[model samples]
Target chain A: MERIKPSLQLKDDIDLHISGWIVQRIGWVLLLLLLIAASLGVFGTGWLSAGHVAGKNGTVSFERIARFETPMKLVVQIEKADGDIEIRIPRSYLDCMEIDKIVPEPATQKAAGGSAIYTFDAEAESTITFYLMPESTGSIHTELTIDNTNFPIAHFIFP
Target chain B: MNPVVRGVAVYLFLLVVFRIMGKRSLSESTTFDFVLLLIISEVTQQALVGQDYSLTGAFILITTLISLDLIFSLIKEKFHLFGKIAEGVPLIVVDQGKPLTKRMRKCKVSEEDILEAARFHFGLEKMEQIRYAILEKDGSISIVPEKEKASIK
Candidate 1:
């Protein structure tokens, strides 16, 4: 029997260059590193607190811009002078942000303007904190009403 | 983000990541590979749903992923180049009873792997008894026995 020598010629010439493959491998590694960094809050814009206090009914303050998928703190301080008041925040906020944890979980009531009203009895000056994570990017504009005062809060989520 | 959009994004991301990992990564799954797959799925679940755990959200995501997979299959069927790029082409690791050492090394396949496949499929004892051993697109070894050896068997 005649011995047949092996042939390595493929029907179609495919680019099997190790350099090209290495480049693609490096690209994916960099992408994964960037994703991990973002998740760890590195290379992320820090919690941006809205300096403007809308103290129409009571002093209500929170971070204006929340970084995408990054947890942030939202604080609302109610004055003793206001007594017991209902704070209304737009329900649409839930679409863009996930509430991880909230301090002093108050009794919630449904309100107009697609908002959820949280009733807080201010025997003394009270502060509530909300840990929030922004889900999407772009501008989020919503109205937060305290008692009869409506405060329009607008923030841009960084991608 | 919409569940459908989130699903598509996750799917694309996973596809790219796995593609970079190479075909063998999917074909050969050890115990550690199974654990890695579970971890990957858990992480993907969080990214796909965010904080939305509603049944509706889950349904939308499942539908979107399936639809995208179907669309890609159709596209692959229509375009040969796309199919090649997406699934890769079958490579000849052993030609005419001779092992292609360079190609096998690049593909992370050893001579032992081909020998094992040959032994399993053809009851062949040596590499010389095998005519061709192809590293398939799906990461399987397809063995073709030598004409004389096959006839003798």
Candidate 2:
């Protein structure tokens, strides 16, 4: 038998620890950057082929924007500044389901002084759109959530 | 509380819960381990980020978890008896260049695993070349080659 040395040994070094920490944090930072990049791509493009826009009671509303059939979730973070958001579903987007009849609880609700959060889920390879109208006539910033998928087909614009 | 702080809290709570479950909660875990891990995440998630989420709530839970881990690791390190109980001691599968088939069967280690370990570890393609083989405490197989090759005579 050859003289065998034991394998387990603890590693130590101030530089190594600092370098390892940097490497670990870099991975997380890259992941966050990728998410932000994908989101920007989705929010900057228009893929929902069909949509409807309505101006009613001092509010301009757009809704029923559907993506080509695919797993899709659209979350809009409407900033505090303006009116109520009115989302409508285009009949073409609802092939087998009736959007008007079925009401889902909003996944999240965060608002203060003219801001609202909305989240919508749609089947993969299906079309979905949302309408945003300010309760008062004013411009507002918008933030959209795309979760884990690629960018949405259409970019959201707030005015 | 900041998200980092919240994460620490949820982690601690899970450590305590899992420790209470047993050392097998981490080692020798089967399908039950996966289910428990999933449920623990869900439960801790709720506690960490509920409507009234607080850093204090999270820190307390996290401290509890780290404490449990430290305690268990300490027990395993300080007490040989507890270590053996927690992590089963290594079983001898081959002794003096002879396979102990009974011991292998008792330890649930297959002949193939032993052969694979020998081939990969010591580059020994034939079992005859191995003087001893042991299934280690950490579920790995170790090989000791025949001493005759080392004899200068």
Candidate 3:
């Protein structure tokens, strides 16, 4: 009986493939890091993408990171409402997104002073959710006014 | 950056990803391997063309991919070490009717796989009939029949 020996007289670098394997391991590590970042909301869908803006009268919550043409939500919770909740947002940023719907339809909607204003009938407290799809891919800067309290908002859209 | 940049980035990314996945994965040995390759290409299509739908974008992207491939091929030609690292060398898992267990294990090749290749290619039923079983770089096993090999110089 003869024992088979492994030999490739041509050219075999399998034994000396250490550096290449190390580079491959580094790539795997970097990919793991990227996936972790994505899971944490860096790409768009996780806790990291969720943002909150607490104003004096209420709080505004929205997605900090979003994809172009992807659907998202903007929530406004009115802590104190006198009679009607007047929500105003700059037309510049409003134009950047297509508002598909607004829950509890506003009683009045109009564009004034470069801002679209929505007047909603309210009680002591209520929440308004804006269903939006980002139309453009870039940084979006805008301001929102909910019953005299203002909140400056920003969003980054991935292409 | 130009739309060509999009093509370059996507092509390079896919290259690195596929390389790390190993040569065997891309050999398309099984049905699932073929399906996986299809899914990867489908996913890459969006990033390759992006928002550009014009003829210019198409031409640019096509050229970008082709150019990158040409550059890699050229690099492989100029550097022997890089070529070996990029594409592994062929391995002989069996020598003169004896199965090299260590080499076969290291290459993820099994005894069954070698005999299957032998039967498929040379109609040899046993390991003794296999003079040489070579695992090619493309992940295919090639069998040399002992009857004819013994007569060859």
Candidate 4:
């Protein structure tokens, strides 16, 4: 038996074409749009806690958003009619988010119900900012208590 | 994020991105292209594991990526049309000592590239000495010398 050698000839059988089908092109366009939107932080969660005033006692406001392994800022403002007021935050929030920095460092801190309560003394009015980073992706919820008033804050972390 | 999921998603994303970029992107590489590739890998690494630096996370991601690649290859083998779509067919850029200028232009393969392949493989200095030049699927060129010239050699 003799082995046959394969022919080495250039044949003009089909026209040269490099592009794919129109549907595939459309898919590529959609994918590009999604990537652009994500880069602009459009998919990430953003929430603002309604301003709560304790009947002239003080005003507390904070904005919350969650991002995976990205630092987040939580700003809290308080206006006290009388003496220094203390703020208590759930410890569970600390577990999910690592405190990277705190503006006007807390006057005192204590552990409560799987949460770290940071106390800040506000003589008249003061604003405290907390820089935090999400350890993982998921829903992280915690309660913000100011002058015995509770505000539940929830953040949805993106992966 | 789950490392396995991240690995699969990254693999698919890269596949589509490269496909959309077209074959020339891989065929032609400059010094800047090399740097861009390194930067892309660095960015992909950050997205793959996020903040998880554990050995288990790395292992899972590696396994997932390899598994996905293997599955894709198997599917390519099973389906001829899919394989052709994924890995383009080889094209002829030269016939009977003549360059197929239209096909060559469409494939982004210049006459110089065919001549270079001819010189490297057959030691034939001129295009007239070559019978056929194939632009292979992997972007390499294949040269077949003219019958008379090959017989003489």
Candidate 5:
């Protein structure tokens, strides 16, 4: 019968030491620093959740400047807290003559100068957002400057 | 402040700090872990940006961090010994239904914790019911149950 010995490797010992230093000690310390720094500064920007996605029945902000060949599409979403909120989309925002869609039968329209205002009522409790036609035309700015003081517009951009 | 310069300094510091935090912090981090993270950022922020911040200071800090990481990664990749050095090996806490008392104490894990992990993982009431138990490098418990085939059949 031969006796067997379990030989210990020097390289293994060195590797374990380095691993302990990096993964357990230094790595942990650095990570803690990062979480804190990012939460307060630039790194924090990527980690925190944006507020615009939360809550309902709020205003929206959009801005686009028209230039050459491609016309811009104006999409608007207006919301309110009460029972019913009304919106008047000015004809200047879209090319109504070229529009093709399932037009609502009960929708009221009124002529305002050379432009027309399309009137529609939305449920107050839930948010109501609608799309304007021509899909692309001149840049439009719809300011949801409704009377109630509490509801503020939430600004967002799509790129 | 110039947004570009501020952005680069801040970004570089965070890159080093987060890399050091390891994968575990992102995985099962507790409240204490979060606090430690916060403090590190506060310290680094002062160094990376502000009136007292110096170009030489930031350069030294960032360079040291990058060099250490690169060296560690290269060693860990090129050789098994270096890899082990860079990452700790799993410690065996239980073998053949017996607890390794020495290893358990070294890991700061009590017999109760070992038993609990074993019981939860293997549905074992006693340590004897476990064939093997290892404390992994990631601070997780791994278990091999006794005669799993027998129980299945």
Candidate 6:
């Protein structure tokens, strides 16, 4: 075939073409990994991120993985309480999240010793649910003390 | 999160995501691509503003994104390699009536795509009637017809 030379003088950078293809392929792999992690609750809610902590008093349940601005819940299941029940939640947790509502409202709440002590009327058994809206994105670790029992909980919030 | 940080993060993430998706992924060659673009913008809006619906939030995000773009443009202008890496260059796929197989394959371009561009752009009927077909930086094909052929309007 007789070659018709093109007058177009476009820069043919050898390295750019090779690097472009290589980079895109790598990006595909990374995107796939991201999707897998997301599906597994690394970014939000999944089996891998549903966490719970148990104490003699009861078991505390919450999402270990969550997203900023996405509403989630922290539940405390109480066993037999002789009288008024007091649960101490850390100020750190309060600082990171805003409690929207509490199921079975507490009788009174006091802020002391860098924690909030919420006193609730004792029932043989009951569940306290704190609807939480994360204030920001980061890892938060705190302990909920119920009747001298400490239940540790941690959460990782994504933006 | 800080508005500036949110804006910057979304900007860079979207840039990387589009780059990873490659040039053709959202080129609007089809109607579905247009719909995908709309969906992407909707999702991006929620992430950018979060819960804040005030004009201040909007202003801050707009300023932050525009500033980032200006800074990146300046940097790319200063660095040739960076610009090429950030935005790909136009490559000639059909050169002198022959398809350049290597670049075409690397770019995920098919001969049919080039022929389609040829027919749509210049009404050229055959590969021989197209002198050169360059895939532009923005994922569109520009065809140069042979001087004697494909002059049909």
Candidate models: Cα lDDT each? 0.74, 0.46, 0.81, 0.70, 0.49, 0.86
Q: Write candidate 1's Cα lDDT for A82-136 as tens digits.
A: 5676777778987887878778877655667677677866666778787888887
lDDT of 1 by residue, B103-150 (tens): 787677889989999989988988889889988878888898897976
Please give the lDDT score for candidate 6. 0.86
Candidate 4 regions with alpha-carbon error over 4 angstroms? A1-28, A31-35, A43-66, A77-85, A90-95, A111-116, A123-125, A138-156, B93-133, B141-153
For candidate 1, the TM-score is 0.64
Best by DockQ: 6
Going through the candidates in order, the fraction of native interface contacts each one reproduces equals 0.15, 0.00, 0.35, 0.12, 0.19, 0.54
DockQ of all models, two decimals each: 0.22, 0.03, 0.32, 0.23, 0.10, 0.50
Candidate 6 residues B1-153, lDDT tens each?
A: 789999999999998998888787657887877999999999999899888889999999999999999999999999987888888887778887889888788777889989999989877889989888988889899999988766644
Task: Give candidate 3's error at residue A64 in angstroms.
Answer: 2.5
Give TM-scores for every candidate, taking all chains together and pairing residue i with residue i: 0.64, 0.34, 0.76, 0.69, 0.34, 0.91
Q: Using lDDT as the measure, name the better of candidate 1 and candidate 5.
A: 1
Best of the candidates, TM-score: 6
Considering just the first chain, candidate 4 attains a TM-score of 0.68
Task: Please identify which of the two predictions, 1 or 2, would achieve the higher DockQ against the true structure.
Answer: 1
Model 2: per-residue Cα lDDT over A1-159, one tens digit each: 112222223111224323433544564576678567545543323333223222221222232332221122333332222233333333222332222221345444454334233344433222233322222212222322233212222222321
Residue-level error in angstroms, candidate 6, position A38: 0.9
CA shift at B19, candidate 1, in angstroms?
0.9
Candidate order by DockQ, decreasing, is 6, 3, 4, 1, 5, 2
The per-prediction CA RMSD against the true structure, in angstroms, equals 6.6, 18.3, 4.4, 6.5, 16.9, 2.8
Best by lDDT: 6
lDDT of 5 by residue, A26-136 (tens): 666666786685565322123231223222545443223222221223333445545334344435443421333322321565665544445455554433333222333
Q: lDDT value for candidate 4?
A: 0.70
Candidate 3 per-residue lDDT, tens place, A43-88, comes to 8868999989998889999999999877999999998888999999
